[model samples]
Target: MTGDFRYRLERGGVKYACPACRQQRRFVRYVDTLTGEQVADEVGRCDREDSCGYHLRPSEYFRQTGTKPPTAAARRKEPMPEPEPSSIDAETAGRSLTGYGHNNFALWLCSVFGEEIAFRLVDAYHVGTSRHWPGASIFWQQDVTGKIRGGKIMLYDAVTGRRVKEPFNHVTWVHKALKIELYHLRQCLFGEHLLAADPVKPVAVVESEKTAIVAAGFMPEYIWTATAGKGNLKVVKLGLLRGREVTLFPDLGAFEKWKAAVDQMPGVRVSDVLERRASEEDRVAGLDLADFILREQAINV
Candidate 1:
């Protein structure tokens, strides 16, 4: 398939430059048939910003991905992925974030964090595998500055031939691969979830997936989605959280800034992770949904 796609952009109203050439292209405001909002500045990059002195402004590279120009009817017909089924009896939402393609770790990520961060992961890691997990495609995100926001590991199921769908599936595989206990898997997944959830999510975002797992223990359900680097936050999908309430869960290192960002969101709450309250050796290090479950068990004990 051809990589170069074209869009009719306006003369001078767009934000980002091209990733390849860094040229500032013109904007082409189109009436979004669904939202009815005039969608200005299509997603794209410049082709001439580097080699040529001219900046091929915004809305250029978005077309570069090879999407066909939509007619009035076709644009209206485009559909979005449906939200995950929510069961009131289940008491909690089935991981707000859906899995991207097939990464076992990525799915676990969604279970822990809400959907916003999972989309961020998908944007970053969609490029296929690298050193971390050979032959495995990671889902992740990066800001326009190319900073890595967050990401996760993934694997395929043997019997089903389908991508493993839940945190338990990832843990089961990890248990088999590393001969680790459910405790470890629980700790890792729960820890990351904590970091992606809660009060004042941290923001000294880093790139190492394992490091993210380790840091996850420090915060519950904060915004710890992985990115390739800075300048790639555009990949982060806070939009997925349009109507829901969210909290800030920061990584161990960047708590202050992370807290600030969380405060900025319209409707988010925050809580502290009580590290000293643990009675068991494997108790999740920080307070989180996972730790919350542990606490309930602790009270019963």
Candidate 2:
């Protein structure tokens, strides 16, 4: 409407709206051999690029002519759906598929732990399929005797009512057992243990149950639990750190993701866990603390 406006070509039939005032002018229709009769352009200009400082591209005629793009308020992506209750509630029961725990896994767990220890078959699906363990095994620890006579790795599968298959591979079975045991401990003892470990102080957090176990084995000074995944950091108890320090020792692989999230917590301090001299001699390096411990024992023997 003012001298500050000039006509410019946008597209064929689409009207040009001022980038600033958004005032639109009627566009003339035109026909092209290729596109046929189409509003291929808009003619308009703003002398106010200095004061108003906004320009519209001829290609924007599609938008100007068709319909305005949704406002920024509307264009934003929907917030990621809140982590579902199933994911957040580790205690919630999951679907039990029949295929899980179809093998004779009790024999396998007893071999790893001991017959004297309370060992039994559990549904792998119902109890919660092991993220790391292939089949399943008892979830407990042992004493110095390399036996579960005093300790029990109790595995309760969330899926089937029966025991799962035993591993054909010895090394694989051992590794699977350890993994199952670690996760079992986390599912069973972690919340209570970590809370009690230091009722009055902040706790150290690790990413893996084995890591937490190994660290606790060496230094009973701090409380710890692995949230399973880096993204699961929110599951760590903020209440435990009401007015204390939270040292985190994420596995080497998860350091960066862990660090970024750890600092977001109010009083979390990132730290490291040093394996004992035995660990070094055993050439052990992995996310699972059980691996570290087993390697140490093997190397020592």
Q: Give the Å error, residue 220, model 1.
A: 13
What does candidate 2 score on TM? 0.37
In terms of TM-score, which candidate is strongest?
Answer: 2
Off by over 4 Å in 2: 1-84, 87-199, 213-221, 230-240, 252-257, 264-266, 275-288, 291-301
Over the stretch 148-259, how does candidate 1's per-residue lDDT look in tens digits? Answer: 2233334444223234556544312222333333322111111223333333543323333433432343343334433322233322335434444444333333345545
Tens digits of per-residue lDDT, candidate 2, 85-147, equal: 211122212222222343224343334334433121232112223323444332322211222
lDDT of 1: 0.37
Clashes of each: 71, 26
How high is each candidate's TM-score?
0.25, 0.37
lDDT of each: 0.37, 0.40
Model 2 weakest lDDT span, ten residues long? 84-93
Off by over 4 Å in 1: 1-137, 140-238, 274-301
